[model samples]
Target: MLQSYETLRQTGIATVRAQIRSGGYASHTAGLGRNLLQANLAIIPQEFALDFMRFCQRNPKPCPLIGASDTGNPILFTLGQDIDIRTDVPAYNIYRNGQLVQSVTEIGDLWTDDLVAFALGCSFTFEHALIEAGFELWHIANNVTVPMYRSSLETVPAGPFRGPTVVSMRMIPEERVEEAVAISARFPLAHGSPVHVGDPAAIGISDLSAPDWGDSVPQPAGHTPVFWACGVTPQAVIQQAALPLLITHKPGHMLITDVPDTAEIPIITNKNMPR
Candidate 1:
């Protein structure tokens, strides 16, 4: 039998991935594997790999490419020795011709020889930092996914990948906003700092209650809504490109990597990457 969510939280990173692979857990990965590096995943055809890489390069803040699997490879040796892109993520969002068609726990049947997998830095990597620094993350405290929105900020275009940037929001206590910013700024691979600090409307997000992705959290008194550049930007770009097929980690459902959040992973890696 699968362990309960609370019990699983006390387990190791590999155990969490094992549970996810076995269909024992298929939910958001926010607080799981705490302080361990987590990644946003995007798997597409090898033909578009170069352009996609360029897109990530052009928009490092929103699309910090942590690692990319070798063409047609399902195993991400750099991220984790046994991290199989096909079934490691908790859940996957299937995009067909740029439209999200389905959500599944695993994509083993859809894995193909022509596919290329890319792992981008995710904001969840910094949540532990904040919590350790004594900041209360409303979403996590309430057992909900952080609220994410489609912002008016445009990303640098690269080939067919061009779209508005996506931003994740967290309600930070007003006085400690600066401290929160300073702490998060250290993790460049994990979306270093706050892109917008105040009003949601200034960035084209009109409603705090309705986010484009993830669950919304209530704004507590004396807290301000802070926004950060998110890795999910690729999904928006993929939608605009109208690609024939694309697979991505379902919003907030990430690939839990063996790498510690403190480690800085290069944009690309080979078999030599340290475990």
Candidate 2:
């Protein structure tokens, strides 16, 4: 059986990495690593690195770059002392010419000298904040992956990378909307605040029951579906570019970083939040 989120909090980061490294644990990381920062992963060939980096720059909220690897380096030393880009994340999604081709626990076999990995801040960061502040997340309370959708909004193009913005939704009580926004805003590393609140249809999402990625959370009475820019935006956009290979963390399987959720970094990975 998979470890419960509460049980995972007791498991240290090193042990968590060990479990994943050995192929013993391959579950979503929503509630694991309680006080630690979590990151979304994106790996691509060196030829596409600069443009991908620029793509992230043009779209900061959905693709908040937290840490990136030097081309050809498998380890991401900045996020954690022992992070191995090839094996740390629980699962990886391999995209071939814009389509998901496979999901694997580890990518060591496919490691190449020309690949660069990028780590982006995740919504998991603010989840810690919400829980700490006593706000319940629709997905976590019910134990499901956060619901994500393809929005009608278009991202600023960077080279061949461009697509509609993707968003993750959480149904918040009509009352706690401000609190949800305030808590999340503290962690700019995470995709900070809601891009759209109240109505999913306004953002071009027609069905709350159906989503592009992850399972849909229950939308109870007295709640509004709140949407935030998601890390998946870059992967979706890059996938549209039809790259030979693009690697990203399977939606909820994030890299648990050693850093605390509130640690203010001098530089946010490659660039600052767009002004």
Candidate 3:
């Protein structure tokens, strides 16, 4: 029998990956493997691999490069002992010439010798830390994907990859915002702290109800929207580049890794604590 989402959260990472690999679990990966690292996927041919690596180097916040597979290889040895990139991710967004062609549960048929898979750090890695600190993430509570937006903020361009930065939004209580920021900053690989807080208009986001990706989460009274650099920025940039081929993990459908979250030990300082 398939385990409940709540039950799966308490399960081991390998079991979760197994379920995902078999097409048994095809949902957003938020709140799963709370202590494990999760990554965003960006697979392209070796011809554009160098440029993509440079792009990630130039834009570290949204594209924190964690691991990459050798050309034609589907195994991400650095992330896990048995992760097969072709099937480990719950879903993949296929693109041809920068246009989304389809979304699929697996990409084994498309895996080729010239393809190189890059894994970028995802903000989902730090979500557990936020929850442990008593911050409420409504999307997870409601079993929906976190809301993501394409902001007016520009990314540092490299090669053919350049586009406005993408961000994930979380509605946090106004009073606990500072602690949330401080706690999250410890996970730099997870996009670190929020890039913007409060007022979506300040960052070129005009509608809170309409998101470019993921589900629109509720905004309760006295809560403020906090935005973090999102790994999905690569999808937007790759779209602009119009590459002949591109495969990325569907937004919020990430590859959970065997590595544990490397969040730094929190410093007990009065300044960082909530007022």
Q: Which consecutive 10 residues in model 3 have the weakest lDDT in total? A: 265-274
Query: Across residues 1-275, which tens digit of lDDT does each residue of candidate 1 receive?
Result: 68766767778887888899999998888878988788899899999999999999999999988889988889888777678888899899999998889999989899889999999989999998998898888787777788899999999999999989999999989999999999999998899998999999999999999999888788888999999999889988987898899999999999888778888774335664545
Instruction: State TM-scores per candidate.
Output: 0.96, 0.93, 0.94
Highest-lDDT candidate = 3
**What would you estimate as the lDDT of candidate 3?**
0.90
Record all residue pairs in model 1 with backbone atoms less than 3 Å apart, i.e. clashing. none
Q: Of 1 and 3, which scores higher on TM-score?
A: 1
Q: How many clashes in candidate 2?
A: 0
For model 3, residues 180-268, the per-residue Cα lDDT tens digits are: 89988988888999999999999999999999999988889999899999999998999899999999999999999876788332123
Off by over 4 Å in 2: 1-6, 266-275
Q: What tens digits encode model 2's per-residue C-alpha lDDT throughout 180-241?
A: 99888888888898888887788899999999999977779998888899988988888889
